[model samples]
Target: MSTKLELPIQEFTTPYPVTAREDSSIEELLDIVKNLKVRHIPIMSNGKITGIVSDRDLRIVSALSAREKFLVRADDLMTSDPVTFQGNTSIEDVILEMSEKKIGSVLVADEKGDLQGIFTVTDALDVLIEILRGRK
Candidate 1:
C-alpha cells in the first residue's frame, strides 16, 4: 500500500503575486501595496524576477515627507536576488528552508526562471489548515 505524499509548493502558493518594476518609485510601489492589501511584492525586470520588496523594507526607509519617499526606487530598497523555488518543490522542504533561514517568503519560479507565484509563511498556514481539515 502506498501513502499519499505531501503536496508540492504550487498547491500552497499564492499564484501571480503582486509585482513591482525596478523603476517603480517607492511611493508608487507603496500605493500598490496599500491598494492591493499585500505585504510582499516581487520586483521584476524585463518580465523576469530580479528581487523582492516587503512592507517592512519600505517602512524602514519611509519618512514623514512625501518627497523623501519618492526619492527612493524599488531597486534602491528591494532585497536583491531573493531565494526562489519551483512549483514541484516539496512543501515540507520549503517549510524547512524557510524555518532554517528565518525568511518570510520565497519566490516560486518556473524552469525558465519566470515569475510564477510566491510562497509565504501565510501560505504555509493555509496548508496547515487544509491538512487539519483533511482537504489535502
Candidate 2:
C-alpha cells in the first residue's frame, strides 16, 4: 500500500449541516446543540456563517446568568464574526487558523455560500494522530 495518508475529514465532515439563525433564541440554540450533540454551532445570517458559539461559550453564558440571573439571546451571547474555513482548505491550513485564532473550532462553508460542518481541535488532532501513526 502507498505510504501517503488519506484524510478522513473530507468524508467525516457533514456537508450542509444544521445551522442556527441569528434571530434564534438562546433556548432554541441550546436545544439544537443538545440534540445534535455538537460542541460548536454555526450562526448563520443571510445564509452566511456569521459567527459561532461553542459549548464553552454557552456554559459561560449560563454561569454568568446564574450569577446575575438574566436570560440572553443567541445574538446577544455569540462571538460574532468567528473565523471560518472553506471546504477546499487543507487540513494543515485549518489547524493553523485555529491555532492563530486561539479557538477550538472553525465553521466550514462552501463556495455556494452554505453552512458545512465544523472542524474542531478534536477533529484536527484526530487527523494528526492518524497521520503520525501512518494510518490511511
TM-score for each predicted model, relative to the true structure: 0.91, 0.78
Measured by TM-score, the strongest candidate is 1
Question: What is each predicted model's overall lDDT from 0 to 1?
Answer: 0.89, 0.72
lDDT of 2 by residue, 40-84 (tens): 888888878777778887777665654342356667778898776
TM-score of 2: 0.78
lDDT at 94, model 1:
93
Model 1 C-alpha lDDT versus the unseen true structure: 0.89
Best by lDDT: 1
